[model samples]
Target: MAKYLVEASYLSKGINGLMKEGGTRRREAVDELFASLGGRVEAFYFVLGDRDVIVIGELPDNTSAAALALKVNASGVTTCKTTVLLTPQEIDNAVMKSGTYRPPGFDEPYEVENWEGEGGHLAED
Candidate 1:
């Protein structure tokens, strides 16, 4: 199982429906959805931001995550973004494996003074 960070923002229609049904109904709805995907929602929250809901869960795979996202998007009442989470050790291992690529472009030190003015380098043009 893999962990995912799922953020969702409800459309007006969905919010209205949720308001009508209340919290327990909302949890049940989410639980059913997760169960259908062979996953479990570890935590969920209603938040204020670009997204209305934040869900942390363990999912079977990327395909399962995409399927869940597609279903929510298809509902026409919410939009979602799913991020696959990685542990620090995973990142360290990735960094160890990234030695093949060579850096590109001018190797001179980047100029901080050149950026002091608004649209700085372009202004000289």
Candidate 2:
């Protein structure tokens, strides 16, 4: 299974619905949605930011992730961004590989930061 980070921002209609149903009910609804898709919701958080909610879960693959995103987006309630999440071992494997290719005009100072993998946070690119 692949993990995904789904950042969801509620549209006005969705927010109105959420306001009536409240957080717990909203979370349960999401859980049901994932379950229907044969996925499990690992974590769900309602936060004040550019995104209204952040969800982390494991799905079968990228297709499952994209399908979930498109279905939710089509609902006219929320827009979502889905990103694949990699574990530390996965990153270490990537870092071990040799690469020399850089994007066009990609000269810039790189900043190094450590990720603790707390909540749904993944390593930054």
Candidate 3:
């Protein structure tokens, strides 16, 4: 399963619903929604900021995550931002792979190297 961080800001209608249904109900609703997609919520919180709610959860894959985001955005009650979370081991595995990319206006592709180094800073060439 892949993990995700979902930040949501409630619209006026959503806030009104929350006021009527209460926080617990809202969390339960989120649980149900995630269950329907074969995912589970790891954490849920309401905070004062640009976003009203934050959720950490896991889904089967990126497609499942995207589906959840699309459904929530379509509800018209809230806007959501979804981020794919990677583990330390995943990053290590990625760093071991080799790849190359050409910069804009450049003719040759530069070899990409593992950037991990002391103090977590990129290694000097």
Candidate 4:
């Protein structure tokens, strides 16, 4: 299973519905949704400011995560963004792989790793 971070903000219609049903109902609805997907909701909170809800959960894969986002967005009452979470060990594994790449307009010349060159002659505009 993979972890995901969900940030959702309720629109006016959703807010009105929330006010009528209260927050506990909203949490229950989320729990039910995850349960139906064979997943689990780890943490859920109704917060202030730009986002109304923050959810942490795990699903089988990225497809499941995307499905969750699409379903929430189709509701028309709320907007959601789903982020794929990575652990520290995953990042370490990623850093071990070698790849070729260039930055910006450095098609002329550039070096990403260790280099021996004149101090002021390194970068160009």
Residue 36 Cα positional deviation in candidate 1, in Å, after optimal superposition: 1.1
lDDT of 3 by residue, 1-125 (tens): 99999999999999999999999999999999999999999999999989999999999999999999999999999999999999999999998987776657656665554346455533444
Clashing pairs in 4: none
Candidate 1: clashing residue pairs, number: 0
Cα lDDT of model 4 by residue, 57-125, tens digit: 988888888889999999999999999899999999996877765656567545544344556344554
The digit string of per-residue lDDT tens for model 1 on 1-125 reads: 88999898888999998899986787788778888999999998888878888889889999999999999899999889999999898888885763332225534444343344675542121
Decreasing lDDT order of the candidates: 3, 4, 2, 1
Candidate number with the higher lDDT (1 or 4): 4
TM-score (all chains, Cα) for each model = 0.77, 0.76, 0.86, 0.83
* Candidate 2 lDDT score relative to the true structure: 0.86
Q: Please report the candidate that would top lDDT against the real structure.
A: 3
Q: List the candidate 2 regions with Cα displacement exceeding 4 Å.
A: 98-125
Candidate 3 local lDDT, residue 51 = 99
Q: Go through the candidates in order and give each one's C-alpha lDDT.
A: 0.81, 0.86, 0.91, 0.86
Worst 10 residues of 2 by lDDT: 108-117
Tell me the spans in candidate 1 whose CA falls farther than 4 Å from its real position. 106-125
